[model samples]
Target: MTVIIGHNPNFVPFNGRGTLRHNEPLSKHTSWRIGGPAEWFYEPTDLEDLAQLIPQIPDNMPMMWMGLGSNLLVRDGGVRGMVILTAGLLDDMIFLDEYTLRVEAGVSCAKVARFAVNAGLTGAEFLAGIPGTMGGALAMNAGAWGSETWAIVQGVETMNRQGQHQRRSVTDYEVRYRHVKGPDNEWFVAAVLKLLPSTIEEGQEKIKALLRQRGESQPMGLPSCGSVFRNPANDYAARLIEKAGWKGRGVGGAYVSEKHANFIINQKAATAADVEALIEQIILSVEQQSGVRLIPEVRIVGEYATTKPFMSETPSS
Candidate 1:
């Protein structure tokens, strides 16, 4: 096992100088519950501590910023360098104006939605159904119904690899269907969201309705990423996969969800490889059968052991 030492001379001091964990299982932190291990993981106490501590780490170390781990898939071989988790720390939300709110990266989407509703804001009701932090939602350009996350974002605060901060506008990023493009080295710290003033009762009612609608459509109690593939233009990926006869197909313990064709479920002891293979199979099969190629909305990363096939291999008798 590779040990993750925290004595990198280049690293700076932060709040209480937190310890590092070696070979920490990525599965423990992710929603999918399937990943090998991370070389190093750190959860700093606050933004000031992180800002001071991050610049001290060596420049060559690979780093990934994670929030809530809702839409990520880390492979079994594990991540190479450092994984910075912001779930436990960086929790702050403030009202900047009647129509605007400032939220830290760690705030959950559900909380943001409810907060807006309580404050009599209407446009942010869609956020209540998303199961992730603001940072992840922003990175994925996550949306539901008719609204995208970027549509409400007026400005964002981001921190670079060197721990320097910058304020950027929504126009800085090239927003697409489910992808976001902006400064490569920066990670979201906070965001200023624009909302419309409305009745508290109306906002609350809208959120309740959206949540009920999601429960009816998605597999609510499964270990899977939300909507594995992005909708292809005006058509739905789930409909395509279902039409291609992949709904009940599986690789090892990972099976395509019968309830929702676009979802891959960890039915019985499914490994990361099984889930990943099933995802690829769905993409390829849909493309070969229908002429349209499907693209994944879930983000895949990390590595796996060489002996483990991503898909099932035939047994040697």
Candidate 2:
């Protein structure tokens, strides 16, 4: 049974559902410490609660899907309609057998990596450093070290905007570097991954080594979305940005990290405009400096603060 709560003053109350907040500041959810508010942000208690809640919202209203907010950039203009917080709910992890593990969308990548290692799985060690949740990993085909998120997926379960569910095999989607194109209007709910048999000590050591490398080369403890741009084929993004002399440069409160040019830091009260401007500047600089046009890896969403246009854009997933 699902329980409804009281209504929020700024937005729809949905007959008092699980967790609802109106005009919720999205900066609190994202990594960059920037962004405007979401008109309605709801965190369901669990999968069943979420399933029930989705259909109850008016059909014409716009909807957005988000997880952990690690690889996302919300515009200074808050989002319209409903924004589903997919991080705290749907958390379930189970070992199906010696080789397969099923993980829910809300579980963090870090937690999955540790769980895999504890289960004596070797291949998942690369996921140890990805700060996003499994749902984000699945959406972006997130990778590190050498292995990508989909490389080990045996199957997946997805939920539509209507909260209907389906199970699909890996063959259902086209997977590429930093991209996963699958069924429209559906997002990952869970995945069953295939992993290699290995000793706990071996997997643990690999995780440590990979994390150590990231720490040495990248600026941790700073407010930044991990990587701003995708690396061109056979070329590193950091190398290109550094060559363009963008290191330590910025507009407003956003600056390119000297430690890693690929990262744009929110040093002091950075606005979404500042970050977006920096992104465009980097893109232009890199294109002029090198012939390769670098595409953004970070998912940019929502709109500017001034205009409230009718919502139509779907959240990247």
Candidate 3:
């Protein structure tokens, strides 16, 4: 039996072991610390709990997945649907073999890198510099230090909206730089990675070097989504923005980082509209000057503050 709560038809109460919240502030979950509330937020306790809760959601209600919340921008009007948070709740990591490891979606990329290194594995050292969860990394093929998440992926387990699970191989999807296209209506639950055998000291050294390079280049202390735009073919996004003289440009409280032109930082109380406006301004100016139309790498979601009520029809209690 399903219980409808409050006046919102989409606000169905979850009876699972996980935590459920209504009107949760999305800014608290994102790296940029900018966004409106989420209509519904659910954090599953484990894989089994997640599977059980999937089918309980209303068919027409929208849903979205979140991890460490990097490379994401939620608009000011907030999300209209359920937001399933998998950051600390789906945490599970184990080795399938000497060189193969299985990591759940909630595991942080840094944790995966450290775990692999401690087990004397290489190739995952670059993950130490990625500031998101493994799930988010997989979704966007996140990369750092010249390596990508999908490069080491051997297989993955995905869960559909109907509480069904499927195991898929690398060939099941088209993986590109900072983008991935896979079976529709399925979200990744876990991934199997194959890494090269290496000494712990070696992996540690590589991770240290990568972190140093990132710290030197990025504004690590600021509230910003790591990279706002993807590099165009044969050129870098940061280079183009800097060449176009867009560094330190501001729109409201949001400004293009002078340290790295590809990053837009929130100095104080920056709204989603502010950041978005800044992004558009940069894109227009850069295209006008460099003839290269830069594409945003950040995943922008939710409704604009000016949009009408997402759910107008009230459900009878």
Best by lDDT: 3
lDDT of 3: 0.89
Distance from true location, Cα of 132 in model 3, Å: 0.5
**Stretches of candidate 3 exceeding 4 Å from the true structure:** 1-12, 309-317
| Per-residue lDDT of 59 in model 1 | 88
Across 120-185, the per-residue lDDT of candidate 1 in tens digits comes to 987889998888899898898899897889899999999998888789989899997789999888
Worst 10 residues of 2 by lDDT: 1-10
**Pairs with backbone N, CA or C atoms under 3 Å apart (clashes), candidate 3:** none
Name model 1 segments beyond 4 Å from true. Answer: 1-16, 307-317
How big is the positional error of residue 133 in model 3, measured in Å on the Cα after superposition?
A: 0.6
> How far in Å is the alpha carbon of 11 misplaced in model 1?
13
lDDT string for model 2 (61-173, tens) is 78888888889889999788888887867789999998899999989999899999998987888888898999999999999877899998999999887778789999999
lDDT of each: 0.82, 0.86, 0.89
Candidate order (TM-score):
3, 2, 1
How would you encode candidate 3's per-residue C-alpha lDDT over 167-282 as one tens digit per residue?
99999999999989999889999999999999999999998889899999999988999999999999999999999888988899999899999999999799999999989988
